[model samples]
Target: MARFDQAEGLRRMLAGPKPRVFTFLSALKEDEKSGMLVNLGVTLARQGNQVTMVDARASEDSIGAWLNASNDQTLLDVAQQQRTMKEAIKIVAAGLSVTMLTRNADCMAKLPPEGARQLSRVFDVVAHRSDLVIVDSEINLEAGFPLASLDDSELVIQVSADPDMIKAAYGLIKRVSNRLGRRGYGILVSGASEKEARLIYTNMAQAAGRYLAVPLHYVGNVPDDEHLRKAAHLGRSVIDAFPKARASLAFSRLAEQLAMSARTTLGIEGVPELGVGLGI
Candidate 1:
């Protein structure tokens, strides 16, 4: 695999279209979130997009952990000048790579001012090198993201059909809105049929709009499929391991919709700037 070059990445940032960064927060189990991220990343990469999955949570259930990435090296190390970008990024497939934002979730908050700035620069370079960056993250106790740039990225809330999960998902949106103020968020329902997903999205959207005045876009859903679990057990994405599986088809469709959305929004004015210095 080719290594990431900082100079080239910087040039790309300046000359090419802005990369789309989507930070996902899940109200489901940890394994479910990790599985969704892995399959989605693989599907996007298979579609010929330059995709990078950044594990911002750094917990045992994070995407990095799901991929069995070494915690010793991370983007934080690169920012601290202890490791190179190439060393930090692990290429999982042709166009898919995974990197951990930090070894610990609280590490970002502990960084000094200069360190925080350097971390922001490192993240900027990494994001520039990819066409799509998928961030597996969680809002901290203070309802702030680990990186300031994530505050400006597209925020997606993942939920299931379970009542508890739906409630938790809505609570998450409320917490984020309380901190970030009014902003649109994408909704992704996992482990549900089309009808169920639509209903879930509608109810949640109505509540959000009526109470919080926040707009929620339905990004689509992933149906319940045992093939997803089997693929994960085989250390492969459903699209790759079980191409004809229902989950595989769902993932492909989801990836298509997300890619289309990204293209349509490309070069649009008023897109929030990313990779700003961290204040968290």
Candidate 2:
């Protein structure tokens, strides 16, 4: 088989209506993070948009693991010609698919330049085929994302009302700004009322602007609801299991807000050239 042309793949990625890519970094526990992503993804898919949730962490606590999608071959495997793209992305729900960046967290950093480029090509292909791509990721010890493209993707930090988690979220934003230079980030507060979420976002936004000169956007919040836990235990999304639940309503509203923002704010001109900066 012939090798994929990195330049061509990048050209195609930039030539058309680019898909909205949102990389989520969370201060919540692994399970909580995964749960939030699952509900959000399902809600988005329910709105008729083709969505793909990429498990870039690939850890036992990643969304893939939470969805029992860990056994699927990863994008790295596709890049290495060990698996086909069709075999890599698994459909977990209607209009929603899941794929892994790499089975091992360190594998990406160890890839050669050619291997890295190939992986980037695979990611570009994935993005072009979807309306939106949600990355459930974390910054590695090297202070970098698994893919360079993620560095340019819309970044959202999921935090909660707990003081410790709030502190950790700010620290994460600082760490990212220090590495990637000053840039805006979206803040989503989980397990809090609307008023509490606003307070958290305001305080964090002010602090970030004053200290790091980073702009923060309030991307809305999810409330504390027992229905969310019940739906999870039933292996179903909150919207599907309990559409009348407060958390379900919140997810639907969030999905609408995000989808509209994505369509209006992102276009072909906003598409970043992939595989340019290999690492962080």
TM-scores, each model vs. reference? 0.87, 0.88
Off by over 4 Å in 1: 1-19, 266-280
Clashing pairs in model 1? none
Task: For candidate 2, write residues 122-215 as lDDT tens digits.
Answer: 9989988988899999998767888877876888899999999999999999999999887778888898888788889899989999999988
Error of 1 at 42 (Å): 0.5
Tens-digit lDDT string for candidate 1 (163-280): 9999999999999999888877888889888778888989998999999998887777888889998988898889989999888888888787666656655421222221111111
lDDT of each: 0.83, 0.84
Identify the leading candidate in terms of TM-score.
2
Clashes of each: 0, 0
